[model samples]
Target chain A: MLLEWILGFVFLIVKLTIVLIILLTVAAYLVWVERKLLGRIQARYGPNRAGEFGLLQPLADLVKLITKEDTVPQEANKGIFLLAPGVVGLMALLIFAVVPFGSGVTLWGRSIPLVITDLNVGLLFILALSSISVYGIALGGWASNSKYSLLGGIRGAAQMISYEVPMGLSLVPVVMLARSFSLVEITNAQSARPFIFVQPVSFILFLIAALAEIKRIPFDLPEAENELGAGYHTEYSGMRFGLFFLGEYITMIILGSLIAVFFLGGWHGPLLPPIIWFLLKVGIIVFTLIWFRATFPRIRYDQLMNTGWKVLIPIALLNIVVTGALVLGTS
Target chain B: MGTIKNLAEGITALLKGLATTLKILSRKPVTEQYPEYRRPLPARSRAVIVLTRDPDGEERCVACYLCSAVCPVSCISMQSAEREDGRRYPRWFRINFARCIYCGLCEEACPTLAIQLTPNFETSGRDILKLVYEKEDLLVNHGGKNNEYNFYKRAGVAMVGDKGTQINEDKPVDLKSNLP
Candidate 1:
């Protein structure tokens, strides 16, 4: 029993190391991918100088960020400003803890699950961590002691709060359909068919809310570069700025994974290995996000609020009721 | 019913926008990758300024300071001196290329056809002082552009040869021959 526990501990360490490395690497490369794809969409080549197709750009960017001078405003709250970036990065990483990438695989006559932890309320864990991530933005903005950053922080806090409700409500139909909050069980439920086919309204609502939640373009009023001069991170420089970007990209990947697990039938495709299917789904979702960025113009702040509260929340509530009634009648 | 129609139309507009971008994404990018492929510039395309020699391999500049005067950025400076042969030349010509706007005004203002613009605009330097080209850096062996037109040969100046011996000049009528 002691030997078994030691082996399990070792495996856990290995898994943690692997996940961290992969997540960080993917987050870095996603920046490159987004640039290249957006460039192509706009009829240009982006960052092709560093390496073959600018593969080394992320490394170059990392070096540049590290070498840059990290400035702290004289009048700013130094402690919170310094800690804010870490909160965002840490919260993003924490959310992935409950996200199952694949089913358990038997190795060395032992069954190993491909997640850090399978929390019973995995969905709630994701929501809570995402909520906590807003503090990173809000605090980073407020601590900067600049009006632009303050405005950005307030906007980020308000937008995130407004969108969080619709985002959570949209997931209700999925939770009801799966009848379990554990991501692993949710995946198992969708072994027959992905939830996207049955609950497309939920999928659309979730997609929109998730896009707003992530502060992507068309809903990126928080960091509206033209108006806010880099928004909440106006005063952030060097590695701190890099940390914020790292957090954003990691959350993008996390959202992709969550969507895959919740709606796209997590890693259950025939012929291909489970992990590959999961990756492919995430890639598609990430590509769509980039495409949306390239296509859509940023909506007005009033339009954004109107769409969120008056439209999305009401639709999500109605969707929940209809889905609940259907589930009851079918059962 | 009206709200539903409006919603449908709004979504359609978004879908149309997405389609347009998707279509462009499928097409080839229009970027011309520099360094690997240099576009051919026209002969008259103003860029790096050069001092050209006369066809006889003589410096064409009379050091008249016309280019220096017309230079908008005041980048050109030179000390004028008369050679032992009575030909004029710049003793220590300089151009602060870092200050040059490539306006071609100096080229247009050049009376001796010595200063001309070339298409070779790839000049870059790590140090600011490196961009300040001296006479040696600007001087070229060949008579650039109008190679046959020597300033000294056509100027009717007595320096290159006697005034009557210059090209396109009328012979001096002698008073002694007119005595008949």
Candidate 2:
């Protein structure tokens, strides 16, 4: 029994190591992807010389960030200021735990699920953790003691809260259809058919809400450079700033994964391994997000709020109603 | 009854919004894969300037300071000197491209058939000093590549003994003519 526990602990460490490496790598490459996609959209070459089409651009960025000095405000809460970025980064990493990368497979005389945890309340866990991410932004902003940062914090918190409603409501149909909160079970439910066909409106609402949740373009009012000057984490420098950047992209990845699992049919395809299909779907979704960033201009703050409450929330509710009716009619 | 219809209208508007988004998704992306595809620039693209010689192998410029005086960046610097045969020529003309705005004002200001803007705008360099163009660097053997008509001839400027000669304009109006 002791040996089994020791082996389990060892396995857990190995899984965590792999997850950390994968998340960091994905976050770095997402930055590259954004630049390249934006470049294509704007008719210019973006970072193609750092190393073989700028693959090493992220490495250069990482090095630059590390070498830079870490500065804290003199008249601010020192402990909270230091802790905020760590909180954000940890929360971002934690969301990936419930995300099922692939079906369980035997390896080295041991069966292991590709995800860290297959929690029963995975969706709620993700929502709760994501909400917690807002505190990091708020604390960082407040700790900076600057009016811009304070304003940015207020905007970010409000935006996150406002958008979270539609975002949660949009997922109701997916949960209703799957009849399980477990991400593994949800993946299994999607094995035969993707949720997109049955819940198109929910899927659309989810995409928009997820984009807003991630604080991407068209909904990036908090970080509006023209007005707020780099937003809530404006005064953050070095690895602190890097942490926020990392957290943002990781959130994007998590959202993409969620979308893939919920709508695009997680790990369900012919003539390919489950993991490959899952990754391919997630990749396509991430690329679409980048494409949106490239193509669309930022929306105004009032317009963004209007879109959440007046547009997305009602549509999400209607989708749930319609989906329920269709399911009942078919039954 | 009107409120129910209003709700239906709102749903239609939402459908329209989705349709618009679907249209965008279906259409071919306006994105240009830049490294693979080069954009075509116009013939009169404001780029760099180059000095040129005439077809007869004679320098087009006669130590004219029009280009220098008109340069907005003051990049153009030149000194005029007389040759043994009393012919005036630029001893040393240089343009510090580092300071140049590429406004093409110098080309416009040149009275002589000397400076002309070309479509070769790709002039990036690591060294600032390398951007400075000397007389030899600016001088081109061919006459203004784009300008078919020589400016000196077009302006009807007297060149040495070729005064009051060539093309429309009866004998330079014989300064003292009263036949108006």
Candidate 3:
């Protein structure tokens, strides 16, 4: 029994280390991919100087950020200013603990789960953690002692808070269809077919809500660079800003994973390992997100709010009712 | 019905924009990887100013102050000198390229075709004084736009040879021979 416990702990630690490294590396490289794809979309060549197609750009950026001066505004709230970015990074990283990349494979005659921890309420955990990241943007913006940051913070907070309602509602149909809150169970339930096909309305609603959740192109009023001069992190420099950036990309990846697990049937494909399949699905989703960015312009703040409160929420709620009725009638 | 049609049109329009960008994305970029691959500029394109020579290997400039006077930026300055053969030239012409706007105005004002703008516009330098081109630096061996046409050749002047020997000349109107 002790040996089993020791092995489990060691396995958990190993998976944790591997996941953290993979997550951080993928997040960094996502920035490069976005720039390259955006450049291609705009008919230009993106960063190809440093180490063959700018592969080392993230490392260079990390070094520059580390060497930069850490500034805290004199009149700003020192404590929250220092703490906010960490909150963003930590919450983004934490959500992945419940996300299963693949099914178990026998190693040394012991079966192990692929994810860090299989939380029973994995879907709820993701929603809660993602909602918590709003505090990071809010506190960072509020503590900056600048008008631009303050306005950005207020808009970001309002947008995030409004979107969370629709985002949570859209996932109701997924949860109902899966008949479980655990992401692994959700993926397993889609063995016959993915929930996207089963619930197309839910799929569409979830995608829009998730995009807003990540503050992407159409919903990115908070950090609308042209208007707010970087919004929340206007006063932040060095690794603090890096943390916010890292957190944002990590959230993108996490969102991709959640969407993959809940809607696209995670790790279910032919002629490939489950982990590879999971990665492939997430890549497709991430590519779609980047494509959306390249295609659309940022919506106005009022429009973003209207879309969330009026359009998405109403549709999501109606989707839940119909999905519930269908599931009940079929069962 | 109107709202539904409008929504459909809006979606179609967005899809069209995306399709256009995607098509462009597949096409090769028009970026001119400058510094490595310079594009061929037109011959008449105004850029760096240069002093051209006459066909007989002499300075074609009459040191006329027209270029300096017409220059909006007043970047051109020179001293007029007279040769032993009664030819006028700029003794020491200087153009502060730092101030030259490459507007081709100087080229237009030059009656002698001495001043001309070339397509070689890469005049960037770290030091400001280095861009201040003197006569020797600005002078080029070629006759620029009018390679064969020397200014004093047909200007009713006695610079190179006697005025009657000049091309397209009528021997100074010939007052002694005119009867009609």
Among all candidates shown, the one with the greatest DockQ:
1
Worst 10 residues of 1 chain B by lDDT: B171-180
Q: List TM-scores for all candidates, in order.
A: 0.83, 0.68, 0.76
- Residue range A171-244, candidate 2, lDDT tens digits: 98899888899998988898888989878888989989989888998688888899999889888999999999
Report clash pairs, candidate 1.
none
Best candidate, TM-score-wise? Answer: 1
What does candidate 1's lDDT look like per residue over A168-259, in tens digits? 99999999999999999999999999999999999999999999999999899989999999899999999999999999999899989999
Chain A TM-score compared with the true chain A, each model in order: 0.99, 0.96, 0.98
TM for chain B in all models? Answer: 0.85, 0.67, 0.80
Each candidate structure's count of clashing pairs: 0, 0, 0
The stretch of ten residues in a row with the least summed lDDT in candidate 1 chain A is A102-111
What lDDT tens digits, residue by residue, belong to model 2 across residues B49-145? 8888765566777668888898888998999987676556789989999999989988887766578888888889899998999988988888875
Tens digits of per-residue lDDT, candidate 3, A228-263, equal 999988999999999999998998998889888988
Candidate 2 CAPRI assessment class: incorrect
- Which 10 successive residues of model 3 chain A have the least lDDT summed? A44-53
Residue A203 in candidate 1, Cα distance off native in Å: 1.0
The residue-level lDDT of candidate 2 at B133 comes to 95
Ranking of all predicted structures according to lDDT, beginning with the best and ending with the worst: 1, 3, 2
Report i-RMS for every model. 0.6, 6.1, 1.2
Q: Residue-wise lDDT of candidate 1 within B1-180, one digit each (tens)? A: 998999899999999999999999988889998899999999999988899998889988889999999998999999999999999999989999999999999989998889999999999979999999999999999888989878887888887788789988887778778663
Better of 1 and 2 by DockQ: 1
